[model samples]
Target chain A: MKKYIAKRVLNALFVVWLVATVVFFGLRAIPGGPVRTMLGAEATEEAVNRMRAELGLDQPLYVQYAEWMLDLITLDLGQSLTSGEQISVMMASAVPRTLSIALIGVVVGLGIALPTGIISATRKGQRSDYVATVAAFLGLSMPAFFIGILLALVFGVWWGVLPIVGYAPLQEDGIVEWFRRILLPGISVGVPYAAVVMRMTRSSLLEVLDAEYMKTAKAKGVGRTTRLYKHAMQNALIPVVTVAGIQIALVLVGSVTVELVFGIQGIGRLLVDAILDRNYPVTQSVILLVAAIMVFMNLTVDIIYTFLDPRIRYGDEAS
Target chain B: MTMLEIRNLRTEFETQRGTVTAVNGVDLHIDNGEIVGLVGESGSGKSVLAQSVMRLVEDPGEVTADELLFKGEPLLEKSEAEMTAIRGNEISMVFQDPMNSLNPTITVGEQIAETVRLHQDVGESVSLSAEMKRKIIGASKASESWRRAIEMLESVQIPHPESRATDYPHEFSGGMRQRAMIAIALSCEPDLLIADEPTTALDVTIQAQILEELHDILEVFDTSILLITHDLAVVAETCDRVNVMYAGEMVERATARDLFENPQHPYTQALLASTPQVETAVDELKPIPGTVPEPIDIPYACHFAPRCPEAKEECFEVDPAFRRVGSEGHEAACIRREPVDGEVIENE
Candidate 1:
């Protein structure tokens, strides 16, 4: 267990290094100077150069990269280029909104998907299964942004039932009101995620049902429900875990679109604004945050494998 | 009175390919305390026949039996609820692969005790009052039943019945897993214990030890066994009466001694001839020529005709009925059993 954890930590550090380096260089290569974009055409070339020096962008690429890495190692993400505030503090403000939206979305997605998936797989070739498959297909095809707008048009504009656009921090008010405000946008973002998870769960479960061990369980004369939940579902969860991990990354991507549609002040929206304004620090920090989460999510899935399957371990150690 | 009697049992499956007859008109009987070995090759439907008796065969697969009774109770007509009650209570089954048979997540002892508690009804007051009831009781079973479960494990010669029983299925070796399966099967002490190739997945030495342990258990218990296997040596060692199956039908049924000493059916003869002798490096071991017919689009008459070396024109035209061959209760479903010319090769 110690060795497994050690290996995972080292692997996570390697991933963070790769992600940070790629983001730094890729943003640098984009077809505009950061200082000129931030200052605009009104500023003189000398003033732009002066601004670039002040921002430390005038340094050689390798030196800038080394400084950034050093800052990152010391947990000093530096101040936002435009805001003149710590990037970490900016993240602290935006991350909760993004996470809340994603969390509610995930819960709703699983709530809709798990039972539906299991039932669809169990009933298999039945009317309900066919209906679920069709719904999943529709959900998969429909874009979250389009879905959000459509929902906002119907419910927010027409019925006036929900706050269609914008976000409220949960700290100012209670969780319930915050949840009520976020529901429509969260659901819109979650629909595709839920559909993907549902399809994966159903397919994986169907395969597990046909496995030899399931037959053995049934032959034991155990109740159908017990056999399904305990025997079949447990085995089926490996792929479900995988699909969920992938969905986390997809959800982060979807958040950008969701933030734009709903007018939510989230990290995804901030990242987009930072890119548009050439705010290097904010954009780099956001990218690093996302990369960190993705790395963490992947690590979580890997760690879960040992628990899910007895045969799996970090370094093929005798457990 | 017979503990279990299955007459003209047939299990047909409807697949996308076509409707297939898996267990075609097979008859089997096991009287009280008799271990009946149902031996055949893989596709011969030995497992299917055993499953059919339990009504474990699911939908799109129909199990039809002219008469199937357990202790004079009609099995075929029983409701799903009724069948559920019968299964794991009056009749318990141990499967071929122990790895697949036991639930992976559940502990070995809990698996056995669950079966015990499912069938029996023991009051909480009665259970609690008993001094021996230190451990948990799944559902409701008498305190004695828990001890009996431990005893069952011990009887199966499982090392460290207490500690080992707590371990899950994946923790066990092949032999130990088979032992745990036997423990679970025998936990309820059902009247009929169906061991469906129980030793097939075990090593040869383990298989022999398991068979020996099974025989010892049978000596003590009043239970009848339906031992299903493709291994002829297993039958010769453990079984009292042997039924030879070919392509879902029973080709021969007789005492183990009678069947082996004086084989009747051509398929049975071929099967015996094919049995590998360890002593001799026989250059050409006789193997049955053709494979068993496909379950779908099966032959109209005798299913084994294509594979039978001595198959005549009549074999293809008519389904040969089981005719009494020699001595009492000995039967075979072959055309050329009578008026044989050659001396039978006896295994010395």
Candidate 2:
């Protein structure tokens, strides 16, 4: 198991390196340089050259790439060219807000999905199944930003239950206030994700419930609760876990739109602003961070699979 | 001394196609300490009948019986909660496909111990010997259930029960997993154990070993067994009484010895002839001529008439009731009650 985890960690490092390299090169490929965006279109060639030289853009791509790679190794993400602020410092503030929204969105998604899926599957043709199915379809059809707007209109503007815009830092405002602020955006992002998970869960559980082992469990006189939760659900979770892992990345990406609608300054919003202003380091770092998160989540899911199924031992005799 | 009794039991399923009667009107009984075999082809409703006894058949499948009794108490009248108390505690089941029968995620031992824990009660009063009472008390404790689980595993002939108990089903060989299933089924010392094709997924050698272990365990545990199988030889070797089922109905029933010696029903005779005997050499193997009738479109008169060699004109027009034949405790469903000669009797 140690060997397996070591190999996975190495693989994750390689993936993060690959993403960093791609983002570094890809950002430079764009027509407008960060110098042009910072200095404005009317800037003279000498001023552009001086600004470029100061930012070390005059150096060869290889030297710049090597220096950036070295800085990355030492956890030194350089300052933003546009704002002259530390990219790391900007990320420090934005990362937590984005992470909270994604995490809470996922928790909310699973919370709604698992039970609804199980109920829809077990009571297949019943009214509850139909209701869940219709609700899932509606959730899937609506976009995350649209849901956020709708929620803001109802809960924020009309009902006056929640603040319509802006984010609160948990450490500054306490957890309760932070949670109240995060809840709307989280649900908006979560609804679509919950629909995906719910559908996956229903289908996966239906297949598992039809398996011969499930019948064996039923024959053993296991109670309905034990049979569904203990026997059927555990087996059903393999596919659901895979889908949920992938959905985490989706939620992170979708949080960008949700963050815009809710006016939360998170990593997603920072990436958007960085792209517009052509802040190369911030854009590349934020994109690389999101990619890293996706890779890590997938790796975690694979590790969880080993724990869920004994038959799936990794780095054993067989590959 | 009867452990279970079923009278005119029928199991029907409502499907998109139509209402399919899986198990037609049937009467079956198992006595205390008896090994009864229910033999049938696939889709003959043997498994459905077993599920009906435990009320394990799911929605859209309806089970109705004139009387479904366990220990002379009507099971049909019992609520699901009452049935849950009886299940695994008073009556347990071992299923086919050892590879899948046991839950793959859990250790084999915990699966066995769970059955014990689910039904364990400390204050429930029952007449028991002092040793049995002490064992029951020990089993009621959470930690002691694991110990009892390992003991049950050992009783089923699993080697190194302590370590093996912690291993998942995939870690065990097919035979060992089947043994583990038997161990779980018998952990609570149920009065009846329903083993549905317990050896079907095993190798021939492993099949014999599992049957031997099951026989020995049954003797020691003093539990009645309802062994469901399609193998005639398995029934002959392991069962005292045998019921031959055809198309959701019992066509013949007798002591294993009598059924083997004087098989009366044409379907039973064909089944014996089709089975390859170890000592008998024949020019060509005789296969049963036709498949079982579809459940929804089962023949009104006789289900086996299409395949029976001795089927007469009446066999296609009338359904024969089960009748006592030459020997006591021997019964068969055939218009001709007498035993047939080697020559076939032409239909007129």
Candidate 3:
């Protein structure tokens, strides 16, 4: 077990290293230089040279990547070109806001989808199953942005029950107010994820139910509900977990649209702004952060398989 | 009194192409301590009949029986919960493919204990108490459960029950897995055990061992068995009473000795003759010519007439009723058993 855990940890670090290297070099290849974008067209050569040197952009690409990697060990993320502030501080503030929306959305999405999926699979060929399947397909086909706008128009603009667009930090307000501010965007962003999870759960459960063991369980006189939760759902969760892991990256991407639609000033919106202004360091850092998050999420998914299926472990004789 | 009596039981499945009748009007009876073998070819609906006893068929599948009684109680009238009480407690089932019959996630001992806890009235303290719990921990209950499992493992004569008990289904040999499944089914000491092709998935040698184990277990427990199989050799060896099903109908029913020695129905005689015997090196075994009819579009008359060499014009025109042929309880569903011109020829 210790060896298995060690191997997984090593693999995770290797993946993170590969991602960092790609991000460092990949951003440099983008059309314009950060030095030119940072300074306006009328800026002097002296000022531009000073700014580039100060930001370490004048250094060789390999040197910059090595220094950045070393700095990561000391918990330093360098400075943002646009804000002239520490990237860590900007991320510190923005991470919570982005996380708050994504976390709640993921929780709600899973909570709604799990029961819906199980019910649909159990009621296979019934009207309820048909309706759920059709609804999930529709949810998948429809864009989150369109859903977000439709919701905003109806709930925000017309009813005036929710704020049309903007984020209210929990530090500045009560829990209810905090929820009120982020809830709409969170749910709107989660709708698509929930639909995907629901469909996955339904299909997985349906397949598991058809397995021979399930028939054995039924023959043992186990109740339908008990059989579903005890024997079926746990086995079905492997696929759902895989989908959820991939969806985390998709959620991070979708949050950009959600932040723009809801007028929330989050990392996604900040990242978009930095890209538009050609703020190289901030854009590079943000892309690296997203890549890093995805790597970590995939690692988490791999780790979770050991717990979900005893048949699999980190270094069990390769299946 | 009869433990289970099923009469005119029919099961049909609604497939994408059309509705197909799997078990059509199968009548069966099992008295206490009686072992009845249901012998037939594949698609004879042996498993379907077993499943219908528990109402295990799901949506797109339907079962209808004119009379299905369990211990004098009307089984069709019972609620779901009541049926559940009867299942594990009274009539448990052991399936053919042992590797897939058990829950993959759970431990073998726990799976056995779970059935015990579900069916029996053991208090929580008594069931889960330190004394009972310690056995699992000390490897004592593990060994005992292991020993018993292995004994059952040995009952089926599977090698090394001690080591085999700790292993998962994938770890065991096919015959060993079947033995483990038998152990699971017999754990609760159920009144009736429905074994659906218990040896079909096993090799010939292992099949004999499993049959021996089943026979020994039944002898000790006084438990009745409803054995479903396609192999006539197995039935001839293990069964006391036999029912021959053809196209979902019980075409012949008699004592195993009577059925084998003085076969009544033409289908039964044809089936017996078709099997390759140990003594015979017949150049070629006569294969039954026509296929079993498509159940959904089954002819209104005799289902086996199209396959029977002795079939008459009237056989294709009218559905035959089950008729008792002579003094014995040997019953056959054919119209040619009556005396005519000093020979049993046609309808009365």
Per-candidate interface DockQ score:
0.25, 0.42, 0.36
- Every candidate's CA RMSD: 4.8, 5.0, 4.2
Query: What ranking emerges by TM-score with the best candidate at the front?
Result: 1, 2, 3
All candidates' TM-scores? 0.92, 0.91, 0.89
Fnat values, one per model, are 0.24, 0.50, 0.49
**Superposition error at A208 for model 1 (Å):** 2.7
- For model 2, residues B158-228, the per-residue Cα lDDT tens digits are 89998888788889999999999888888888999999999999999999999998798778889999999
Clashing pairs in 3: B154-B157
Docking outcome class, model 3? acceptable
lDDT of 2 by residue, A166-256 (tens): 8899889999889999999999889999999999999999999888778766655666776777777778999899999998977997899
Candidate 3 residue A188 Cα shift, in angstroms, is 1.9
lDDT of candidate 3 over A1-319, digit per residue (tens): 6787678678777877787777677777788777787687889999999988987779887898888888877978888876789988888888777887788778878887898998898889899999988888887887767778988999998999988677778888878888998888788778788899999999998899998888887777666666776667668989999998889876787788888998887889879988877776677678778877887788788778876665675555543
Instruction: Pick the winner on DockQ between candidates 1 and 3.
Output: 3
Highest lDDT model number: 2
Winner by TM-score between candidate 3 and candidate 1: 1
Alpha-carbon runs more than 4 Å astray in model 1: A41-43, A310-319, B122-149, B278-283, B338-348
A141-260 per-residue lDDT for model 1 (tens digits): 998888889989999999998887777788897877798778887887788888999999999999988876666655555567666765677679888999988788777788788888
> Which pairs clash in model 1?
none
Judged by DockQ cut-offs, is candidate 1 incorrect, acceptable, medium or high? acceptable
